[model samples]
Target: MAVAAAQELDELCYLSAQAMGSLTVSEHFHVIKLLGEGSYGKVMLAVHRKRGSPMALKFFPRESTTLASFLREYNLSLSYCTHPSLTRALGIFFSTPDYYVFAQQAGLYGDLYSVIVSEEGMEEERIQRVMAQLSGAVTHLHSLGFVHRDIKPENIFLCDSSCRWVKLGDFGLARAVGSTVRAVWYESPFCTPEVGPAKEAEKEWERRQEEGTEEEMEDTWITVEPGIDSWALGMLTYCLLTGCFPWEESTHDDRRYRKYEEWFEIERAHDKTDCYAIMEERYRENPPPSQFHGIGSLAMALFKELLNPEPKQRGSPEEILSYLGGPWLLGSEREQRRRAQEAQKEAQKVSETGGLKDELLREGKGER
Candidate 1:
């Protein structure tokens, strides 16, 4: 939770060509240092000289036909930027045919992945802060009709003096309702395999007919829902608490059908002595967070609700906000009285104005 010295921070800065060369954005910004790289492109710590604040500039190479998608993602991120736990997408600029630029407020402390790996474990209070922040951010995103799709530790960052602020980043895989694109590895457990060409569909149908029985067929396929995010979140919470993954390498040699079976056996056999054991049991049969030691009870409760295997059983963002004590839903319990007053005020304002603005200023409209 302590701030690293300037020299120490400087040592952590990585340099690469992606961070060195000038990015082709509509407007110019000083590229300071490379923050990190990903499958799509590199993110750099940049400074808008005129604005006088550090920003993260993500550059996407134009060869992959992902320009339009990346632009849409960036624009979507901007709409949810006001939440304390969410990163703010300032603006996006595309200057050339081969590059796309995404600008965001820079976090002084790095990502949760590096932080957890470096510190080994975070304090309970810090962990609770992070969960509360993430819960708020996710709730806000859901309210705006978006799902992060990818919710790994690497995509969460910390800012401010005590590294208390948590921001969800990397919107490239985020999806709105009706979006067909899916994020690999972060795929929902319920996701069905993508149907390919006509021949492929025919083959799949034949395979299904061969399998027979609804139960047997369901076992052979997967479906995805918001619950998948919950599962990933549970994995993350376990990593934060135990400093390891629940499904560590098993001794079995089965690489295909039998691998998961072998791993599940191992998971079942592990003695409930350490944090890992608790995690394993929770993965198998979720227990309330209050049962866990050294972790915030509220956070664990939220985790249980989020990671419920049954998508229908999983908690909604509003429910999560309540569990985290979010301010949006707090106040007096006289619901209908407050609602009536608010409705009257809205009616008065509408009568005064004739109607709502015909053209609402949609935020985050441009591409990065």
Candidate 2:
């Protein structure tokens, strides 16, 4: 049958790919089909030859980047390896001049974006489970002093079994707490614009260029806080519940940016637009979750808090966990509050410390 022939060809491709370059399939891992491909690399599904456990192998081009860059990303990804709601990075392998491979635990059910699109309608319980898993993953990342930077549905995967454990993966853009240069659109609105050299800076550079005295542009960057991740989380929740992007305009409105801008201005002028009012007026502001046949007010509230434009006002992961009635809610909230108190104490201690030993003494007292 045609299906049988296709399967055979797929097997051949998998075997050949596993053997490509420096990778060997000995008795450890048997490569399956390609899982997905992105701008930087590709992910392939492989099963442990002896144990039969599935895993993912991501291949990146080492020649295209420096060792420092690879090491930074590797270390950041490693920090979350122990989180149950996150995909585990197994190891990194360098086989050929063209490839830098990263192996990780595989997800059986693929990404949430594809799953939701295929199923058409996800049950309320399923949606909550996915959100809770995502919240936990994000919270863990924040606690570890890192930002995922990208939290879209395509990056979230599900396990194979009936339980469908959600796992947050794909850390290619993740960075340390203070690093900026976040992916466009996903950047927090509260963060300053990622504009190039200011007009004055550019003009000065031009004048210096004519005189051949121009200094190289210093690498200026911004600092994004955990609040930005919370905003993207809101957007993802909205998309999952509505099956459409929060800012995407409907065809009936011609889906034009100009129209969207106009509507945004109107909404800004009058803050009294109800859910129905916004949906009917702009057609770009997505319909409320309550408008969705199966979704309810709790879902709507979650989305609203997540997407609030003000960064300081955005809900913390602890707050979100509490809102969802997650098991970790109470403990996480207490931990967050404790950390805040400790931070305030540390700040006060620093103010009183005239020298390094004073700071150390304060820390010693706290430890005791």
Candidate 3:
């Protein structure tokens, strides 16, 4: 996507912010610029009028989100955003007649999706640091009994372009339920079999529509598990390693995923079946099957754990820590990148002990 120039972006951001009712908002904040906007609403860069501190103001339109749903999301943001690797929401939430608004520490570098697109892919060592932070954040959220249902590239924000500071954001789809029944309209790449079959789930969802259900449900009831986030983490790691996706979606309807699923099924029965070999023989002329080429053996091993078709067999997000000690890039790329990153860090080391959680807390209490 083409990024607008600084002047044009500022002008465009001001124009977008002008469309919303600004009386209450302007009283609290001076809109600095528009960060990003989507179907949900706009996220604006603003500064507190009284404190003069920067914040990212997220606005959810009433037409798109209900009061209950919006409040649920806001509450979850307040409850769990405290994790350093989780985007920290300011202790502020209020509603306008047309919007539900909240504040967060400004993610100056934008989201992970933009980074993946711009940088092509990341180095193995950086991926390690990123996954380390994310795994910790996922574990933190799950430990509190909440699942970040939507853990995708777009929702993972970057505080630094190099991904040294990344956080998981967007809790609109998060649910704390022991089990949930949602209406699935489309196949999602991050979901696995135990999340339930997409075709069957869609039928149930459609039945709800046929019955004139007022609120659209998105999935069929299934017990919540860490596999949900683990599967997504796999997808995130895949994108970080390879700029492209292994499949369009995880459903059988997707040809690429079907090929992968078939291989995985056989892989279960024959533990000796090498995925890399299958890629070489089957798609020899087709850029190799499953995009498994060029990745390290250890990474392929990790992928099997994260992308296991069966959710019951899927690895937890915390399992990523086990692989951190090993190489994830093929050949000498891992050592090369690792040493370069170390040298880069040696110049100016950033302390990891006091992170955003403490900083945000102090800021909230007016102690910073």
Candidate 4:
């Protein structure tokens, strides 16, 4: 009974979003429930009073922000994006005396973070499908010469529990390829540092990091790099498979990240078929500071490409497209495991038959 009601609610939300097209500010849409609220604004589940369609409406208070800030995200979601994996605005933007209201697609299953917490860890097959779409979404954005500066799980929406339909959200921070990105937030002693040009302000910050001191540094920024999205993609993939981030931060001072960096050097240079086996042996002796104990071989390979320490060496999101048909594809891990078990059985059977034949020949010779 409850499931049915939830399904009906989801359908209404989808229909409401569709019916909300060409809507005007004067028209009323009643708020059903508050989806979430942050400093930027509050998102509410709303329905058109006349058409009875659903949408998650974001309300930005007029006093808190300017028109430019609202329009930046609203215009990008509505006009620039046409891909299915990327979320879209519902073409509704208006302002009351106190607030600027924007409507967007309502996710039935909420954001990817919610699902990750509930499921603990997603299966590799499911991760493959969801990551494929996200990778495409990132590729599409890159093709437009824009980069999504933030690509965390919270910004990713799951249209369904199986994650067959997912969308990337929160493009407000996206910028042009060569734009200078000042820190998203001010850097403090407690905050992580950035790596800019060798002569840039961040060089001194790097020195501070190397010296194991957290003394305050001057303002710093870096030019947009190619692998920013790729690095986040690798982190997201690792999170989905393990239900935790590989490391809390990428700073060299971070112990967990340092361990991963050490292993990554070995994993990157050695291309032998027995490379994974070698890693397994070393892992047993001294495990890295990550929860990625059971990751499959091909998945690990993709992670290496995406998370290369040198940003320029990291592969693009589109590189994941080819992996869809390879071992990184859905069910590939289980399929490989099954094949290995089958081969072991076949070899055992052959050995047993050889022993039986030899025993029979010996008995016959003894009788003669």
What TM-score do all the candidates reach, one by one? 0.58, 0.60, 0.73, 0.73
lDDT of each: 0.55, 0.58, 0.73, 0.72
lDDT of 2: 0.58
TM-score of 2: 0.60
User: 296 in model 1: Cα distance from truth in Å?
Assistant: 8.5
Model 3's alpha-carbon lDDT is: 0.73
What is the C-alpha lDDT profile of model 2 across 41-74, one tens digit per residue? Answer: 7888988777777778777777675544544444
Put down candidate 1 lDDT per residue, 1-368, tens digits, no spaces. 01122122223222211243434442567778888788878888987877767788877887863645665656666655578778877854543567667688777678888867532455544665677677777777665656676787878887854557878888776655444442232122222112112234445667887888353312122233455455556556656655654343211221321343343344445442345325534554633222233344344445445544345566655454454432111121235348878999999998766543432323234321
Count of residue pairs whose backbone atoms collide, per candidate: 5, 1, 10, 2
Ranked by TM-score, the better of candidates 2 and 3 is: 3
* lDDT of candidate 3 over 233-265, digit per residue (tens): 998898888777788778767888888777666
| Candidate 4 segments exceeding 4 Å error | 1-27, 185-217, 270-290, 325-335, 343-368
* Better-scoring candidate (lDDT), 2 or 4: 4
Q: Quote the positional error of residue 144 for candidate 2 in Å.
A: 0.8
Residue lDDT tens for model 4, 178-260? 76766543222112224423234566778888999978777657767657888888888878876777666676656777788
Error of 4 at 320 (Å): 2.1
